[model samples]
Structure formats: structure tokens, C-alpha cells
Target chain A: MHTVTVQVVRPIGDDIQKKAAERSAVLLLGCPQVPVQTSIALYLLSMLRKKGIKGIIAGNPAARRLVEVSDPDHHYVGEVIDIDRCVADLAEKKRDFSLCFAFIHNDAGVSYAATIGSLSGGSLVALIYGEHPEDVAETLTVPCEKIVVKATHNPMPLKNKIDEVLPWVVSNL
Target chain B: MGCLESLKYEILLKNASSKESGDFIRNHYDEVHEVEAGYKILDKHLIGIPPIAVGVEGDYVIFPYTKPCYGTFLVRVAVPEEVERLRKRSK
Candidate 1:
């Protein structure tokens, strides 16, 4: 039988041990079917790093590949764990994250965000966009901070929204 | 590793327990793949819409089942000879 392993990829930087335990964030991508999700995830990862918060992006293989190929030269995508494994680890208390940013464009995305946010014991921040902002918000059952920008198929519209949410990262709240 | 080796699912619906949900999926899906842990509740991929994420790897299918109360399950399902042959050619 072929075996699948759920290994945690530590964030890159000096003081790796310290950063892993400190203000950490988990960025979850819904699916690679939407190109914009990767863009927004990478953008948020950069912002989080700038604020001294080490972040890890989690998603299925396709979604992870989208981010990986985008920045082959720089470790822009950084570390990732399988979405299934990540949730299991969080539930088991094997890994801890201080904040969670989930890009929600569909029902699966909302479920993912809620699972991670609730397990992380941190702020569950939902990034909502696309044609229907209110509609998507209504689908989310878990309590979380929302970053809504009404843009479909394009990540450009989210720059302002990302800026607005930057303080949350800087404050590390 | 025991949990990962054998597949399980947790039922998320309030009215139904994990045992009830697991029975329903088993009856519907034909076979339960080998997963590491007990089944978790992942009733809905969307609001009121229950869907499962299945992963295809070689001759095996990876099923992601969720229970709202527990977590998610990563189960590996093996395909039969004829089905595997068809899957190979279709790819």
C-alpha cells in the first residue's frame, strides 16, 4: 500500500524555532480552479511576513501548485500542508496558528476557513469577493472577520481591501 | 498513523450522530477506503449541500470526508482492475 505523510513544513527565516511558535498565520486557498485565489494568498503572505508574522499556506495539490509555479525563484508560496492534514493537526493540537485568512468564493472555502479558524484559536478572517459579496457572507456559518471586495476573476480589486486589513496583521491581533 | 491507515468519517448534522452518517456514506459509496483516523463531520461543501472531495492517485482514490465536530478524513480507495484500466486510458 502506498503511504501518504502529513509533514509540517517550517517557515523559512532566522530564528525558525521562535517564529514557528510566535504570531503565526495560516493562509488557506480554496481551489486552483480560480486563478485569483493564488494571487490573493501570495499577496497576503507577503503582507503577513512584512509584519513579522510567519505564515503558512494550505490547500490541495492543485492549489498549492498554482502558488508554487507563480514564484519559482522566490519562496513566495513558502510552506504548505495538505488541507486535510492541516485540519487534522489543528484539531489534534499538533500545530497552532495565531491567525487564519481564508479566501471564500464557494461553500467549500467557508467550511475550510471555519475549521482552521476555530482550531487555531485565533482570528478567523474570511476574504470574500466575486460577484456576490452578501451571498457568500451568508453561506459562512462560523464567526470570523470579513474582508469583502466585489471582484470576479480578477485580484486587482482586492488591493484596497488587503490594505484595509493590513492593520490586523501589524497589530497581530 | 492508525487513524491514517484506516478511513473513517464523522457526521456533522446535529440530528444524526457519526455512526449514522458513516452508515449512510458506506451504503451509498460502495466501499470505505483506508484512512488514518475515525470519520469526521463534513456534511456540506456548500450551505445545505453535502459533497465529498475525492483525490485520484494512480489506482487509488483519496476521499476527503469531514465531520463538523471532529475534523476531516483522508481515505484512500482502490479501484478494481477493469475500472483502473478505463481510468488509465481516459487520462
Candidate 2:
């Protein structure tokens, strides 16, 4: 069996989503790794961290900001995208990654992540509401699930998000 | 992460739960169609509707591929306005 480690994160608050988007957009300026609006990237980043996969982020200032949320210790920033490349590079290994987890606080972010996930392949997408999420289902063509999130409000708490969904991912993936 | 329903719908498609399938989809007609673009609530023609990957964000939904992909052909059920337009054009 082929197995690649990935992480899932959900920053469950409004301000965090906007900041993450703005931060990602800023990094996306000339970067080519992936779109800054890519919610899946953020979600996948978390998964990468959990499984201790080699990771690299496209070089950019915004990526630096995302480092603020993704890797506060700052060690993994440069390693982010490199990790995905390494795993994708090894697609012939055995079994590819099955699921990724993410925390979203808004509609725009959700669309970006899911769209990118679809582009990549069959990936899972989740949105963590901050108590009041905008209901915008008219735009999606992917299956969605609803789950509860508990937080002291760190927003996109990577490890925390994954633990909560591990059961579901294991069952589904 | 959030938008629990979107996650659940995605799960359903991946591993269909026969019991809660369209009934839940039907109950949330306005909401479902809004998120599930080109999706109508008629049971009779469900078989005809192509199964494209779908995901939802609150009330709005998104379909992945932009152009009509070659291998698959889906007869999407557009909203009433678009349906009317198609009807008018056909006649």
C-alpha cells in the first residue's frame, strides 16, 4: 500500500479566514506553487505537517505570512511545497494520500479550496463555521458533510482539526 | 473545516447513504439548488442528470470542470429561468 502523510487544519473564525485569504493572495502575486486562494493548500499544508511529509511553500512574502498560521515555529515554511512535490513526485509509490482537512470561516475561501481540490483530484473539503457561516450551496458540485468544531478560537488549529476528523477520514478514505 | 453540510454532501456522493440521499436534498430544495448549480428537485428525471462532482459553500455550490468534458455527458437541470430560455429556444 502507498501512504503519504498530510495534515488538516481549520482556523474557525471570520477574521482569520479573511486574513488567510489576504495573506495567500499577497503571496500569490508572482508565486507559481499554487493559488493563494487555494484553501486546499492551507488544508493540505496541515496534513503534510501531521504526517511529517517533506513540504515546501512557493517563495513569496505572503507565504511568509501563512507561515504565521501554518508553522509558527517557522521551520516548516520553506519545506511546505517541496513536501507536496516530493509526495506527488512519488505518485508511483503505492497508495496516494486519501484525505485532507481544512478550516474555513467564509464562502469565498471555501470555493477556492474546493475548486483547487477538484483540480488536484478527488480530495475532501470541509468548512468550519464560526457559529454563523454564510449558506452558499448553489455554487458547489461536490459532496459536503457537516460536523461540529470546538475551539478556544485559534482558527485553523492544524493538529486539532485533524484529530477531530480522523475518524471520518479513516472511515471515508 | 466548517460548512458542515457541504462536507456531508461530499461524503454522500463519495459513499452514497441510500436512506438520506435525495430526501434531505429535497427538503432543502432552495438551498440545495442554490449551492448545487443546474440542479433541479424533480425525482423522475434524476437518472438523466449527469453526476458531476459537487461541493457546497453555505447556500452556493461549485462544479469542478469548466468546459463540457469529453468522456462524460450530463443533462443538467437548470433553474427555471434558464429552463424557460431553453424551452423557448427549442420551440
Candidate 3:
């Protein structure tokens, strides 16, 4: 696992000790044209919440709507945030999350994952799914824990990888 | 006003491929940022799924605009606000 050293500047007399407190994890989902990505996101959200982590989902309107519709009861996730704004905030250091899981199925997904991985002061899991996941993974140059699986119709391969990584992530957190 | 809403000036170059547009921007502009397709530019979602070049030229911003069935076009729009925002983010 590659570590990222993020330098956060705080106001004087601020609660510096709170830096070690529980920070949130963001799941950056790509705008999926298929149904499988939504299913995988739902699974990831449930697992993250179960682990007692403040999990937030960020994506475009389409992706957000898909997740929202799937979890109509809002059991897995609450409000779905806008991915572009989230990226901008992360870049400006206006927002901070401890861990990030960017779902990559296209080149744009890779770029988003790399940008978030480089900006966030946390661990990034570049979960590359869909057909030819390796092609998408190759574009991700940032150093982060990557789980590449060629599973577009079925989410088992990626789910297994997530299961293996979640324990380690929670323990470290 | 928002960047897209305040498009006072625009220069569109037709028959331009993604690589050609990227090269044109790189050769002309001093600062260039590679943004992926589907990413938003001033709240406007960029089309396509490949990475495109967004370059800063003085107070203007240059990026690719793709239309389905039609080829990619290089669009140079004067949006100083977006230029400032991009500068801050790039820093």
C-alpha cells in the first residue's frame, strides 16, 4: 500500500489533536452506462457503513440517481454528492476525506481517481472494473491500492477484492 | 456569472482531432491541463470519455468540444473567471 503525505494547514489554536480523529471516506463512482457499476457501488457503500466509517458517495447526476434509486430507503448511502464539485473542493483543500474508493471503467475514471488520490490526504483504492479493466488500470499513474478485475456483468471478482482490502483498511484507520 | 453562461467570445476550429487540438493548445499556450472527458468545466459537463487538453491562454481558456457523429473541435472561449479558478486549482 502506497502512502500519501498530505500537508494540511490549520488555523492557530485549532484542535490539532483532532487530526487523528475519524475522518470520512469518499466513494467516487463513475457515470456508469451499465447496471453492474451501480450494484458494485451499493455493495461497497454497505460494507463501508458496516465498518463504522462515514462513507460518502460522489458521482455525476446519472450515477447519483442510479445509486439513489437502488437504495431508495437510503440504507446504504444518504445524499449523493457531485463528483466534479467534490474534485474541485479536494483540489482546493476546501474538503478532506481520510480514504477514497474511485471506481474506474474508463479513461476519465482513471483521471478522476488519480486526481483524488494525489489530492486527498488518505488511502485511495482504484477499483477498476468492467471489461478490459487492465487497460483502464494502465492509465492510472498515481500510487494507490488498485483492484483490477474484468467483471462487468458480475460483481464477484471486485467484491472479493474489496472484502480482502476492507479489513486491512479499517484496522489501519 | 458562470463560465458557460458568460461566453462572450468563442473560436471554434472544425475538423480537428483530439491529438491535433491537444498539440495546438500545447504549442500555443504556456499552461496546459489535461482533463478527462465527462469532467465538468464551469458546471458544464464535457462530452466524450477520453482525456482532453484544457489550456490557459491569457484571459481565455481553450478546450475540446466533441459532438456525436461529428469530429472533435477546439473551442477557445474567453472566461477569465474559469481561468482564475483553473490557475488556483493547478497550484
Candidate 4:
């Protein structure tokens, strides 16, 4: 009779701790005047969550409410934080995010993205969308990855871009 | 910082365009933050940089008021409602 002995190796100490330290990402969204932007944001939130990245939505009161109401189950989104405080904290280095995705559709969005990209020492992607996303992208002078798609009423283009870029973003993290 | 003054009018300096005013505010203020379009400062939406310096001294909310031809002026307005809203939002 031949007996086989098996040794099971369990990850301990640093290895387990490293795996437990899940990376966090912040979705910096602006006040969307159109419904499509909100739709795209929700889609992106789902994708981020599926990728195992903890996503925090930072925006104004209305924008925050939009996400809260849309994702009432909290299935895809995490804590909804104030964008102003988020930016201040990032600048002060009090809060550090592994990745940042700024949904830029207007000038204010561009400014927010530029500010966050400069402060956040992580991968930053300026997802520019709307009527003339190119125009909005031009104002984003900060050196960061950008995905500009003319998607005001249609969410397909923006959604596709997100799908394409998400893998690269996760790899960077 | 003294007793609250009962002034109710806004001071607008329209000596510069919106872009120029925004640039000026960004250059001048070290801690400027972006406010949404409909945010009430002095019973009106600020036209300068979306990001503006908001300071509180006593019961007054000090911010930059900008108009096309009037440029930008660091005006303090006594609007407790708006001030309270800002305070709440910041938290």
C-alpha cells in the first residue's frame, strides 16, 4: 500500500496582509445637466466594483444624491463624499486614493479633474463626455490619461471607452 | 471683526471678462475651491472662476464678485442662509 502525504501551504503574515489591503478608487463626478452622463457614471461604477476596486463617488450635493438615489442598494457605489473636501484632503495628503476617474463634461469638471490629477499621486483618467467632449478635453491641460467621447444622449460610446481603459487602469494599480 | 453690519447690497466690478476674472482669482487665492453653477453667494451665481476663495469673518461671507466689465472684487456679503449652506456643505 502506497500512502501519499499532502502539505497545504496557507498564506500568512505579509502575504495575507497585502491581499487584505484592497486598493481604493474615487470617481469624481460633476453635476450632470443631462441624464446620459448619470447613466454612464452608474455603468462605470458597476464596472469598477466588478473589478474589485472600492469606488467612492465624490461630487456636489446634487451629484451625490443622484448616485445615492440611482444606486439605492449600494450595490456598485461606496461612500459618497463631498468633492470640495475630497480635493482639499487629497491636496493635504490626508486621503490617498489608488486611482481617480474624473468625469469631465463641462469647464468645472475640467478644473476639478486638473486639480485632482495634480494632487493625487496615482493613476488619473479624465473621462471627458458630452456635446463637444473635445472642447472640454482641451481645457484639461494637466498631464493625465483622457478618454474623450461625444456622448451627450448616447451612453454606448462612453461605456465602450470605459471598458477598454479599465483593464489598463487596474493593471497600473 | 466687529458687530455685524446691516448692509444688503452686492458690489460688482465688471472690469474683466469671465475667463480673465477666473484666472485672476486662481492666481490670487491660494485655497480656492469649486462651487457649482447655482450656488448662491450674494443672491447671484458667481461668474468668475468656478473655484473661488470663500472666507468667513464674523457674520460675513467674503468671496470674489465678478462681472464682465467690472472685473473681480473681494466682496463680503451678509447672507446667513447662504453662509449656513456653505458651512453645511463643507462638512
Show model 4 residue runs off by greater than 4 Å: A1-21, B1-19, B22-91
Tell me, per candidate, how large a share of the native contacts it keeps: 0.00, 0.00, 0.00, 0.00
Q: Using alpha carbons, what is the TM-score of model 2?
A: 0.34
> Which residue pairs show collisions in model 3?
none
Full ranking by DockQ:
3, 4, 1, 2
The CAPRI class of candidate 1 is: incorrect
Q: Against the true structure, candidate 3 has what lDDT?
A: 0.73
lDDT of 1 at A5: 97
Top model by lDDT, which number? 3
Q: Candidate 4, residues A44-109: lDDT per residue as tens digits?
A: 778777776778888777778888899889887778898766776775578878889888777667
- Candidates, ranked, lDDT: 3, 4, 1, 2
What TM-score results for chain B in every one of the models?
Answer: 0.30, 0.22, 0.78, 0.57
lDDT of 2 by residue, A1-173 (tens): 99988886666786654543332211111121222223434554555545433233432355335454655676434343322232223232322334433233333334333433433333444544443433433333345453334322344543355557654554443
- In the order shown, the chain A TM-scores of the predictions are 0.83, 0.42, 0.84, 0.87
TM-score of 4: 0.66
Model 2 alpha-carbon drift over 4 Å, by segment: A1-64, A68-74, A78-102, A134-141, A144-152, A155-161, A167-173, B1-91
Query: Which stretches of candidate 3 lie above 4 Å from their native place?
Result: A1-21, B8-24, B27-59, B64-74, B80-91
TM-score of every prediction relative to native: 0.61, 0.34, 0.71, 0.66
Clashing pairs in 4: B13-B70, B13-B71, B14-B69, B14-B70, B14-B71, B15-B69, B15-B70, B15-B71, B16-B71
Error of 4 at B5 (Å): 14
Q: Write the per-residue lDDT of candidate 4 for residues B1-91, one digit (tens) a residue.
A: 2222346545433433334545544675454445643244643444333354465544656565432122345565666766677777877
